[model samples]
Target: MISTRIWNALPGPALVRLLILLIVVAAVVLVLFEYVFPWISEYLALQETTVEET
Candidate 1:
């Protein structure tokens, strides 16, 4: 029953290509949020703040 059903299912190469694309996109997004964006934000905030008499 299972083998017959799989014979009628979608192709394997398409599924593999889709999974690889998803993995690459996820890795790039994670690196952007985890390392690049936070460092940029911290640098900008430090530049904005000043020691003033109040």
Candidate 2:
């Protein structure tokens, strides 16, 4: 697949490549949690409703 080809094209030893991949994955996760999650939460927030009786 394209990803496998790209992975094979990366430079350095297997360990170095693995470390780089891990760092990239971590960065993506951190960005999503820190930025994307909060932005999505703002739009998805639940509102409380009040009912009145006469």
Candidate 3:
């Protein structure tokens, strides 16, 4: 059964569908790497610890 009618609105062949899905995944990953990760890192600062000099 079709869970939602909105999804069916994107009519396309199998290859086209696969390409669109790939593009969407790539876009999300790009956003994470380019903006989201860097912004989050500023707050986390997961490397704050430092060794003392003798």
| Per-model RMSD to reference | 10.5, 4.7, 4.4
Q: What's the lDDT for all of these models?
A: 0.75, 0.86, 0.79
Off-target runs (Cα >4 Å) in candidate 3 are 1-9, 50-54
1-54 per-residue lDDT for model 3 (tens digits): 472453465569767866776787899999999999999999996879888999
- lDDT measured at residue 2 in model 2 versus the true structure, 0 to 100: 92
Model 1 lDDT tens row, 1-54: 985564446346767756766777899999999999988997676657678998
Q: Rank the candidates by TM-score, best first.
A: 2, 3, 1
Order the numbered candidates by lDDT, best leading. 2, 3, 1
lDDT of 2 by residue, 1-54 (tens): 997986798789999888888898999999999999888878874555567998
Candidate 2 Cα misplacement greater than 4 A, ranges: 46-54
Candidate 2 displacement at residue 37 in angstroms: 0.5
Q: Who wins the TM-score comparison? A: 2
Assess the local accuracy of residue 32 in candidate 2 as a C-alpha lDDT between 0 and 100. Answer: 100
* Structural RMSD, model 3: 4.4
For model 1, the local distance difference test gives: 0.75
Question: What TM-score, to 2 decimals, does candidate 2 have?
Answer: 0.73
